[model samples]
Target: MSLYMLPLAIGPWQIALIVIIVLLLFGGKKIPELMRGLGSGIKEFKDASKEEEIEKNDKKE
Candidate 1:
């Protein structure tokens, strides 16, 4: 049962193919915009995490 239920693993080739598909679908011009949005999302997530940590420290003090 355990062997039959093992997860399928993703390899580097599969990741490359996915990236190629995304580039083709979005076109060359839109890739930068997509990356920029992704960057901002990561920045916002980090900011929120820092704010939560500050609030926790405040409560302890």
Candidate 2:
């Protein structure tokens, strides 16, 4: 089966409710640390992809 390309259906109210739930669950203080870790993980993923693409181009040339 193929994945669909449509955007996720969450509206603004849904987003606000999810944020409220997260705040209640993790509290205000822990969210920043969580976000920082998430950011670093994204950066590492991007760096890895770029390295892989460079390697592919090097092998082709």
Candidate 3:
């Protein structure tokens, strides 16, 4: 039963490697823009999903 909680761990080296990959993929100058675009897209998706749920509820009512 206790096996489910086996600790999840990420070390500093793993973080550094992820950072290096991001920098190489996006380049230093583009990272911020990419992040902003990602943020906006995620927010838009969330809003669209919520709107659809609300519309469904309204139709049911």
The lDDT values for all models are 0.92, 0.93, 0.91
Candidate with maximal TM-score: 2
User: Model 1 shows how many backbone clashes?
Assistant: 0
Model 3 over residues 1-61: C-alpha lDDT tens digits?
Answer: 2665534466788889999999999899999998999999999999999999999999999
Residue-level error in angstroms, candidate 3, position 51: 0.4
| Candidate 3 Cα outliers beyond 4 Å, as residue runs | 1-9
TM-score of each: 0.78, 0.85, 0.76
lDDT of 2 by residue, 1-61 (tens): 2355335666898999999999999999999999999999999999999999999999999
Q: Which model, 1 or 2, shows the larger TM-score?
A: 2
Candidate that beats the other on lDDT, 1 or 2, i.e. the better one? 2
Ranking by TM-score: 2, 1, 3
> Which candidate number has the best lDDT?
2
Whole-model lDDT, model 3: 0.91
TM-score of 2: 0.85
> Any residue pairs clashing in model 2, and if so which?
none
